[model samples]
Target chain A: MRAFRAQAAAELRLTARRGDAVLLNLAIPVGLLVFFSLVDVLPRPAHVAHAVTFLTPGILALAVMSTSMVSLGIATGFERQYGVLKRLGATPLGRPRLLAAKIASIAVIEIFQVIVLVAVAFAVGWNPSGPVWLAVPAVLLGTAAFAGLGLLMAGALRAEVTLAAANGLYLALLLLGGMIFPLSKLPGGMRDFARALPAGALSDALHGSLAAGGGVPGRAWVVLALWAVAAPVAAARLFRWE
Target chain B: MHRSDHPAISVSGLVVRYGDVVAVDGLDLHAEAGQVLGLLGRNGAGKTSTVEALEGYRRAAAGRLEVLGLDPQRPDDRTRLARRVGVMLQSGGVYPAMAPGEALRLFASYYDDPVAPSALLERLGLEDVARTPWRRLSGGEQQRLSLALALVGRPEVVFLDEPTAGVDPHGRVAIRAEVARLKAGGVCVVLTTHELEEAERLADRIVIIEKGSVVAAGTPAELTSEGGDAAARGGTGAGGGAGVAGVAGMRFGAPPGLDTAALAAVLGAAVEEIEPGQYRVADPGRPATVAALAGWLAERDLPLADLRTGRERLEEVFLRLTAGDRGGAREEEGR
Candidate 1:
């Protein structure tokens, strides 16, 4: 446990030191929420009075994806490339504990992201009528799913490839997952495709359980739960130390 | 730190394969606690693979490998075995952004009782770069920090891959001292390096491997001495003091294209300009031959460069063994 904490602290310091990752994971999500909320380019959400109400939930979900997947995966890929993972694997901490530490650090960064995004959302006239606490499970599940994918990508692919894939996927999910636009706006087939993705499920789950909607949709929760389990299992089975 | 009656590491018939490449083939290695076993080999001679297999980073295709009586190759035993072993990788095993101080502290946390990070920093001569990031540190500093990370856990056994490979003279001294300290503290140190001097200075016993198997292993004194019993018993009888040309020879570099025929006539011995700027006397065991060569060199005013004598016979022994290995390796590849 002591090893886990030390490793977690080390991983967090490395993650935080990366200027590009911070810009992608923390700044971009916050920037998107604030910029889109102030602009009228986005279609007014069906039931929500202001766009901030709709954007807030999806923005939080996006934050989870960026921190859990893009930031964590790219960093892990490079660390593995540089033989850091192999070195840690040789230690008494072992791979399982090292992995636990990495996820723990991701969770720590997610908390900071939440506090910042929520404070900004509140300042932009966003108030919730439905259960806001549901976002907790919603965010946690999203984090697990994305974090697993991140590790899977990092452990299985080359560092350069992971960098490109993580960034490319982040953009695709941002534009297609209803984080910036409504799922209803994506054409029929495209909307279904977007909804089938974990990013989409996370966006819907957060949107439904936040102030803009009442109660969580069964399908969104089920999709998230399936992904939350599948991605991590795949990552665990396929992850390599070197 | 735990006392064990048996050797710290024991291995026999170890086979490690990377697809078609047999990296460690039928290799045998053993080291008791408090012993420094120097593993010497040329590039691609399976030193790294052997170390990795023992360290539990690579699975042996076939063999019995025990570290502290635990088989590191077994998945179930890896972590348990890891608790008692420290490994220093060849390069870049640390986060580029992490400082030596932070890395040592992090690695120290893994053990129930770890050496203080500050103590390690001071010992490895890394105090000035304790706060510097790994990427920013000089190559020698990076190596010293890597060594410090391995020792921070106070492991009972340590595997250091080229610990002093690119280190400066001071860094090399620090590493050698720490290795000696580890030996005194009853820790087994298995070091693989191309630095022959390090092996000669630090290893109580040295094993030289080629094509995945040990060709010669004995104390440095035994291997380097021309009449040492190890040469008589060394595998394949390649150890017949056969260097450059078979038998005792004096080799030196002077001007290229020396008059070998005239020099041989003067010494009444076989002499040859083996390559550009390099000459060899077939039998330097005769002082008359030495005098004749010196006279000939004096007549030519040719300055000798790196003229080695008995001090470097381990290198002579190594050259003899690996010389045969190169031909065999090429034949195997050709086939």
Candidate 2:
């Protein structure tokens, strides 16, 4: 347990030291959210009184996308390439502990990411109508599902392949996850596919709570819960240390 | 630090295959604590494969193996065995963005009880660069930092794969000295190298691996004595006492040229001219070989031009043993 904590701390420090990752993961997402809300180039629905309310949940989903997929995939892939994972594998720090540390550090960064994006969302004009506490479990579940998928991509592919694939996944999630645009605007087939995605489910739940003035459905919560449980189990079974 | 009476590592009939390349064949080997075992071999001689298998990084296709009394090849047993062993793999690289001290501390965290980073850096002569990032350090400094990380776990056994491969002479001396200190501290060290002097200076016993089996292994003296005996029976056996000279033979190069009669007079019968240009110089006290030879040669004004000496050096022993063995064939073909 002590070794796990130490390793987690070290991983967090290393992650924070990466200037570009912070810029891309934390800074860029918030910047885009604010910039898009200020300009009306992209059409907005007339009934939507404040675009910030609609934009807030999408921006939060973007935060999850950057950290859980892009950051986790690229960093872990490089760690395996450098033999860092191999070194850790050979220590008293067993696989379980090493994995726990990775998850813990990512969780820590996600909390900070959430806080910064939420603050920016409020300043831009988002006003919460339902219980804000509901977003906690929703964000936690989203992080797990996405991080697990990221690990699967990282552990099974070459670092170069992971880099290309992760970027592709990021762009697809941005479009189909309904983070930048409304899923109702998509064609019928694409909207059904997007709704099944964990990102889309998470965005729907958050948007219902703070933006749409509708209650978050039990069905959407179930999808998020199923993904939270399944993706990590898959990652744990198949993840490669080196 | 258990006091169990067992070899630190024991292997029997180990085999590993990568596709069609059988990296390690049926081989039996072991190393005890408090001794430095040198694994000497040519490239692709299965040295790395064997070591990786022992470290649990590579699974053996067939073998009965025990590292620190645990079967590392077993999937469930690997983590238990890893806790006790430290590995400095050749492929492991430093995080170039991390400071030296930070990197050491990070690796140190992997063990329950680890050596302090400050002390390790001081011992490795890495104090000046402790605050420097990995990319800013020189190649030798990076190598030393790697050594420091290996020692951080305070491991009972350490595996060093080509620790001095690209290091300078001075760094090599320091690394060897540190290894000697580790031996004195009762750590079992397995060092793989192609350098003969490294084996001679650091290994209490050397194992010569050819293709995947142990071709020769023993204390340095025992291996060298075999050379002396072979020289005694070779073509120049007429120089009976020349066997004792045992200066390691040269196959293609011109032999040393020193006046034997003049050398014999200088040493007062201690030096005997057993054959032309080949003199048997004996020092009962085991005086420095070169300095005494030079003094004796100078006293007689003998042009010590090409006085070829013939005793088996470790390199000759290695080359002779491994030169003919095929990569996959296990049966020995030559003496």
Candidate 3:
């Protein structure tokens, strides 16, 4: 437990110190929340009254994905390339502890992201119609699902390839996963496909909890749970220390 | 769990393969506590593979390998073994963004009881770079940082792979001193290096591996003395009693065509004219041998130039052991 805490603290320090990670996980989400809310670019959904109210949940979902999946994946991939993971394998902390530390650091970063994004949303006159506390499960589940995929890529691919893939995936999910605009904006087949994805499920859950003041949807929870369980198991089986 | 009589490290018939190519084949070696075992080899000689396997970083295809009397290849033994064993890899064990102090502290936390990070940093002369990120550190500084990380846990057995590779002369001296200290603390150290002088000064026993197998293993004195034995033996058949020179023998300049038989009789050991004007006395440490050589030179009015005893150097022995295998195509890759 002590070793885990030390490893997590060191990991968090590195994550916070890295300029690219900070930009991707924190700055970008806040920027999107302020920009999209003020610019009026998002086509308002029929049930939503204001763009900021709709974007708050989407922005929060994007924050969770960016921090847990894209940023974490790219960082882990480079750590493997640099032989950090291999060295840790030789330490008393062991593999499980190292993974725990990484997950813990991701959770800490997500918490910071949430606090900052929510503060910015409130500053922009956003009001929640749904039970805002329900966003907790949505964010936690989203983080787990995305963190699993991130680690899988980081462990399985080269650092440069993971970098490109992570960024590309982030953009694809942002545009097509119903985070920036509703699934209603997409055509019928695409909407169904997007809804089936963890990214879409995360956005839907966050929207239900924060925007509509409703409980998390059961389907969204199921999709996130499946991804959360499957992605990490796959990553563990495939991950190489060196 | 503790076996006091067992070797600190033991390997028998160890084999490591990268696909079809063999990196280490049928290799066997051991080191005891408080001893420094220098593993000298040419590039691709399987030195790194052997060390990595013992550190539990690589799986051996076939072998019984043990460190601290525990099987490193077993996953269940790793956590316990890691606490007692510290490994300094050839490169890249630290996070690039982490500061030296932070790296030390983080690694130290893995042990139940650890050396203080601040003290270790000071001891390694890294106090100046405590806050410097790993990527910004100089090569030598980075190497020292790696060493400090390996030592911070107070391990019982340490495997250092070229610990002073990029270090400056002063830093090298400091590292050597630290290694000596580790030995004094009863830590078994297994180090690999291309530097013969470093090995000579540090290793209690030296093992030279060639083509993934040990070609020679002995104390520094023993290996070098073997070269002297070869020279002495080679001359014995030709000069009879006139060429039985050991490593302590002295050579001096003399006039050409001087009578060596008389000198051999006077010294009571082999005395021979190895070159045109150079006379060698087989045992210069003997009072009579030095006296006879000096008296012979004075009587002949011969001026001795380059008069020095023949002490075989470790470099010569190492080259002789590893000579034929140099510049060959690598038998395997992926160390």
| Listed models, DockQ each | 0.85, 0.48, 0.68
Candidate 3 residue lDDT tens string, A1-242? 88999999988988889898999988888998899999997886787888898898898899899989998999999999998888888888988788889889988988888889889999999888777787887788888889989999999999999999999999999987777798778989998888888899999999888876456779888998888888888988898768
By TM-score, the better pick of 1 and 3 is 1
- Could you give the candidate ranking by DockQ, starting with the highest? 1, 3, 2
Report the backbone clash tally of model 2: 12
Candidate 2 structure quality by residue, lDDT tens digits, B227-304 = 444322222111122223124432111125555566456544355544455455544323345556667656666555
Q: What is the C-alpha lDDT profile of model 1 across B1-335, one tens digit per residue?
A: 35878689999889888877787778888999999999987777788888998988887999999998889888878888777888999888999999999989888899999999999999999899889999999999999999999898888999999899889999999999999999999999999976778888989998887778777788888777654544333453333233322234677788888878887888787877767987777665466766777788888888877564333367766776677546445122101
Better of 1 and 2 by DockQ: 1
> In candidate 2 chain B, where is summed lDDT lowest over 10 consecutive residues?
B231-240
> Which CAPRI category fits model 2?
acceptable
Docking class of 1: high
Best by DockQ: 1
**C-alpha-based local distance difference test score of model 1:** 0.84
Model 1 TM-score (2 dp): 0.91
lDDT of 2 by residue, A136-224 (tens): 78888888888888888888888889889988888898888877787778889998888888888888777766654557777678888
Off by over 4 Å in 1: A212-214, B229-289, B292-312, B324-335
